[model samples]
Target: MQSVSEEIKIRPIFNTQGVCVINSVLYTGYECTLFGTNSQNEIVEQLELESEIVKIFPVYDKVLISTITGKVYVYNPAERNNKLQCVFTNSVIKSIDLDGEAIVLGTADGSVILSDVQGYGETFNKKMDGMITLVKFISLSSIKRRYNSKNKLVAVGDAMGTVTLFNTTGEVVYREKNCHSGQIMFIGELGNKILSCGMDALLIEHSLESEMTIRNISENIDETIGACSLVGDRLFMCSKDLVITLSADLKIVAKKRLNIPDINGFDVFGECCVITTDEHDIVLASVVQDTLVVDKVLIGDNDEITDLLVMENMVVVGTNSRYIRTICKSDIERQNENGLIRNKAFSGELVKSNNEECVLSMCGSNKVFYTGSKDGIISKFEVVTGNIRDSVRAVKSVSAEAPITAMCLYQDLLITGTEYGIINGWKIGDTLELVFTASASSSEITGIVVNNKKIHCTSKTKEIIVVNLNGGMDSSISGHKKGMWSISEHCQMLLTGSSDKTARLWKGDINSTLQHNTSVVKTLLTERAITATSDGVLRVWNTTTYKELGAIRITEIKDERIWAIKRYAGTEYIVSAGPSIVIIKDSSWEVEKMKEQMQKEEYIAKQHAIIFMKKGEYVSAAVEYYKLNLERDLKDALKRITGEMDISPLMSVVLLDSYKFVKRVSKWARSPYLFTITQRILQTAIENRIEISAKEADDLSKTLLRTAELFNAAY
Candidate 1:
């Protein structure tokens, strides 16, 4: 398999429902299209079904697909007109997993059905008392070794926060009620233990022993764990916004928060793990002492990464669009100083578009930005910045089909101009509305700007028209020989680029027709005025002096035309937008300064926590450690304050990690002072209304009582 290129690839899909990888091929099923890619990242097969496919599974040479209409179809990619293999008229199939001798299907009607490979004979079927969300197949050997069972089993996780294990014979091997606070999202077998996670921010590990005891290992309120896998002694898991590695006992050994969209799925590859998210990026990470070190990040060009498959030395990735890419592992393993696997050069094309609308105008202040497409749609987003990069959240949208040619933002008002020379003023509150409309020109409005309570607009009429906010023409300056293509204002200077292949820099009022000017090829204004014309060459000039300082050629494209130049505030970088978006990084030293500030804050907090702990202020120390969110430090504080106090933090720990409390107390909390402390902690927790699980409370009581009897006998 070849490595992915520096330029991100693009794939198009109608609507991606789910993606899965089997053997050496990756399969993604969307609206009505089922596409497959091989290890080489080449499209090998595609089958368009009748209905939207919800889940897909490959069994030997046949592909099985479950649709939204509660039916399953089996077909060979090489064949046509596939017949319905099976129909569940009453139950909508939500998920499918392959087991030893049965295919398990989870349904929306709280039932699980196990059938033969061809779906002709039923093996086992049962209602799980709630909507079945996920069903994981457990091999017979693992179940027999753990619980001494003689039958193969399947683990069913439901929406009502229950996980039940049943044999292929429809007999329940073990059932844990209230395994999580909310609906269970994932269920899998991690080595000898049953691993499950839910929307309640809970990760549970259930032993396969006949007793089938339960333990709550991790809890994160901000995100929910969606996928997990086991590699050696380390367990890798991912949430909507984080990827973490934990010990077999469930202690967070390392973690990395990507701050991206919701994670769809992930699979482990060698020492590294590949993760897929709802956006157009795939992250590869490895565990290194208390940190999930990011090895590389694969970003797609205007695409959302839906699923991925990991082979020996290569990885196959699927996107929302029609493209699948295979990449070699060694290509990303190359070291870099910035720790980013990004292409040094910046160029971007439109990735996800429902129509052929090109983005024409974009403007924003700070992190909130808006873009206008040719289809007359305006998209609003809030930017989320982090230590490494930034992402966005779509806020709202507005639609109008006149091909918004010009836009300006002023306080709570947005002024827009259409190609038909119509200027519309809008008020943005709960919803966007047009408050006033006026005829600015008879020709297409090319560019618009708002300054000092006045809107200045340029059009194909070869004139700059000025209008007041209340809606009346203030002035008009006509000088350019041809229609204006772009316009900008800086420090009372009006810069205009026209189709005559020339740009003029006029340093005077718009009402004045005569001013000292400089003839240039084409021009855009930021801190400095940048010009480009003929030769694909870009020259930067001082806005005040108009002196040429530096120059570079746009070699990424043959015919380069710079249409828009936007600078991100607080950074020296600028984004040039046209047929493609290119980022020009001028000063990147600011990134190091931001990293240093974060490290200093963490160091100061840790020192303060140590001081508080040394002074025997357990509650104060615990509060500081809680800010760090390390389980070991929090447990130490809990042990120190056991009998002396009952704080809310301790109660949270009890509810979040009960297994640690019980196991740790049994091992090190054996002395008389420690035993008394343990008793007091549990007693105070029960009296003060901590929501400890029944299973945990019982285990703690039984273990303590048995230990007390042994101590009395020894004494």
Candidate 2:
């Protein structure tokens, strides 16, 4: 599988419905798209469907996807075919599960459908009360072999909080009504008991023999249960801000408070869990000492950004909220230095406005900055350099009859545009003094630029009004077929972005209209003219030639809109803001090349290790696999090392701590020869008097005794 290139790094800008992890690949569904990511959080595959994705089922080597349009398709990533095979179509599929080739689908209309993947196979359909929310095929053959009865069972949960267990012939084996107050979210089988967690924040355990509730758990959970998964003998239930781990007997093992307030989806893989938040951040967490610690956070912004201003060493971000964030360039660089796997949070300083309304526009020059709010209030702020850090303080406030929409600094004047098509120029000193006022347009003014002592502004009426600084000599220029959103000026060139999905550059009468795939929302000018579109792409165009240079996709969510783009003044870095801020450096191409080289080298080394294994050079192959952190391959190679003479080299390769070594080999206790060899290694380590903690030694000793019992029982 081809991984995502290093030239592009995705910081999530929106939440997904759910996440699934299988074979080390994470699958997530958002709107009409399904994305698959590898262990490194890089996009490996993206499948765009016709409708919104509803549910995903991992069936051995293939994946079955259900959409809101009631279509079911099967995809096999291991195969060469990229097209999904449509198997069935019915009412909106809410959940699905598979046992071998038998497929079970639960629909939103409270119907259960059982069929095979070929579509023409013998099918059975049954209807129940309320919408069917969850479905699973559980086997109880091993625990009930003495009954001499059918073991394949189908468990279904409905929106009315009813759970029903059925046999293959459509016979209802057991039924429980009103198991929860709200919709059922999850259903799982634990030995002879059935586990069900519901949106009512309740986890219920039901006995198969008695057909009654064995236990009901609602402690330490205040929010609705969103999802649940089974790992080993433990059950993991997740709410919006909490996760509870329970033993097989329904006893709470650990309760962890995940600080994320808006969790959209989460999935547990091995000892770690991945959480996707509505704030567009992907949080990676793991249990350490019974506490869930956030190991890394893929940072994203919280709200829609309104404007961005580039200053000396900081980038000021104005959001739709009544607050502006100041991000230091040095802080961003420092976070980037923590390696790709570490946390990437932009810990910026937040400055709140006195106004209760949202910010609409912003402009700054040197240490002084101004912000215009939706309530016709404009606040002036100055940067206060303190002993430790820089802060912003409000200096003065001014108001107009209408909301301020755009602002720009020209010479010694601060020119502002209002929603009522009014323009005013003010001189900045200890206080603001209005010098000139003009009626600019017929509609709300969206953008403003001052060039050659002339004030030019564009409005929602698709007209650009140009006037002198004295508010005289006003002339209207036909701007675009649609409303213009942004405007920029560099020397004699004028650039304007419009809702007509085009950016136009005008130098005198000669103008060039650059067509884009989506509506242009913002335009910026550096050495090149850059236009940001609603499709999350920033396209760069040569100003003089009006030729397209390249395009960068700033976000994965299509049509998310790029609100603002600015050149980090006097640098090759470009800062773009939307739901999050992204800074792209000029050396990205070289960095991409270096990363490609590293991946190639790793692949080559893996190939060499495989060759060594095939050639019976187990010691060399083990070393190479250890270096690559391929634990499975390293263990397999170590198992091949036989005879007492090879013990020295084997000990050198298995350089793990005493506890970890026992834990590793305990998983393979069924293999008699390997277990014997591992026993010899442990004895040698004890003879060497390797230092170990008392807790670790006790745990190691218990694990070894269990492994020995299993080995003897198997033999």
Candidate 3:
């Protein structure tokens, strides 16, 4: 299977925990490291910190990172010597927000401190009843213009589920006791309303005038609200497995299930939202016509895969969760070819066949599969045709005395090995009837295989127990120093992975030992022998020559282990699972060529745009820059076009709908230079009597005024 390496392309099929976006760059905090990726999902920087990161906030061009140890550090990515400089050290900081130069910190000890970034000391400090969970600065100007002098009000959410607003003098302006049944997850402002979501799965909008809830919604959201973000006027709330979008009136606009159950962090920029999962996967989604669409997923380890089975046209994956996901091979191919949008969900059917227990082993024939669970229950399911709510139907289930750890099918018999080293043989028919049972070893059985009317099984005893077909002990082979994890047979050749950090290939009495850097968790035998180790790497070896070919790093995260790897029969598709599910397809040269061609076209267009800009062709350059999403260059070209008297050249930038233009230039609100240039472009358009819809004109005017205020505060 040396050709498998050349023909196959590995892609994460399913989609970090702490993620935020600022100025188009995505920052994700994993462990004690902060990773920054650009819009194209390229790693821009990686900063290692002293402690586990708790929260990250964008402060002008710098990022303020708070740790679990109550230390705050400032990171300036553009600096020559990029380093984290400690700014403050106090009690554990649970939440943080910045307005102008003032930093508001909510501590786990129920203290809220208002300090400056310049280390000038705390301007105001106060203690509350419960541990502060969230703190945000909300502007009071919208409530009353005269209050603008003392406009900044601190919105605080505590562990007791209370929401409180305080002025600069620490006097409570508004307080709502027990606003939620659980700890608050988010607190922010939407016009004159204060929006807050909590672990109780409630999204409440409080009126600034009356200090009461204007609208509270719990419909369509059943899990804890992990995070919430604002895109334009829409409020997007992310729960365990769903993303719910609400309108300004707190009405449910759209809801989508991402199939990612453990969301750790989330943030939004423009129309795009980024989610980080507990497994370290980063999912980037966008709002398209009111629906949340997953654009790309940076897969991370979320669950430990227990078993893999290829049944019919589907690759069934059993994870640590109670469900088994069956991915259609055709769907994988179609998604790989047409890009992931053909099926909006971008996932497969989830079958909860094992009740609440984790699936340990799987065996199948044709469209029928049997799963063994940790609860010692065996469930048989048949894949049904057509659009059924349940993709698989349970035909029968049986309880074993011990947890089933390994299973295999031989002709009309199903053989299973259990946690107590008991080997069982059942006659397959209308009902699963036990035919024979024998003690294989004293330790837990890990693998079982039947060949030539003989049974070969490995267990925690570090020995391969051989038994006759009629429940009699034949002999035992000993070689491995530790318990074997997995075993497979192909044409009389046997491959076994063991906890001793070695995979041994045996043909007759002669065996070749393939040593790995870590414990071998899984092994597969095809044309080549593939072994998965605890070091998160797959080592390929030529079965015939027993020579190591190469290794693939399956998991990028540190200390992550590969738990399962299986190849689909008669196809070049392989599925590996650990933190995320990855689909490896063979004969994918066409896709690679297509990607290369697209990159070439983008490079050519960027070069042409640069040439046009140098030659003073502002309109032509603006068109190219806009198409390439080079926002900086596009804005510069638009500013230059405004200087000319011709209204047609200005059309290249100002002719679009106001919402699109506002979103495109929203990032520039932090830069005084770009902000002024944007203002000049808008002024020129109005002065030239450019025809624009009344709605567009109003939206543009409001966005620019808000941009002006933000620009002044940032500078």
- Write down the RMSD of all candidates, one decimal each: 29.7, 23.3, 22.7
For residue 154, what is the lDDT in candidate 1?
A: 86
Q: For model 2, what is the alpha-carbon lDDT of residue 547?
A: 71
**In model 2, which residue pairs have backbone atoms overlapping below 3 Å?**
none
lDDT of 1 by residue, 4-75 (tens): 012222233213434445554456664576766443333355677777777665555566777877777666
Q: Which of candidates 1 and 2 is the stronger one according to lDDT?
A: 2
Please give, for residues 271-389, the per-residue lDDT of candidate 3 as tens digits: 67777765455678888867778766654333666777876677777777666666566555543332442211224555565455788899988878898898888888898876632
Model 3 pairs whose backbones collide: 16-276, 16-277, 16-280, 16-281, 16-282, 279-301, 301-579, 302-579
Candidate 2, TM-score vs. the true structure? 0.53
Candidates sorted by TM-score, best first: 3, 2, 1
Q: After the best TM-score superposition of candidate 3, give how far the Cα of residue 555 lies from its true spot, in angstroms.
A: 9.2
The lDDT for every candidate, in the order shown, is 0.61, 0.72, 0.73
On lDDT, the candidate that comes out on top is 3
Q: What TM-score would candidate 3 get against the native? A: 0.61
Q: Which candidate is the best by TM-score?
A: 3
Better of 1 and 3 by lDDT: 3
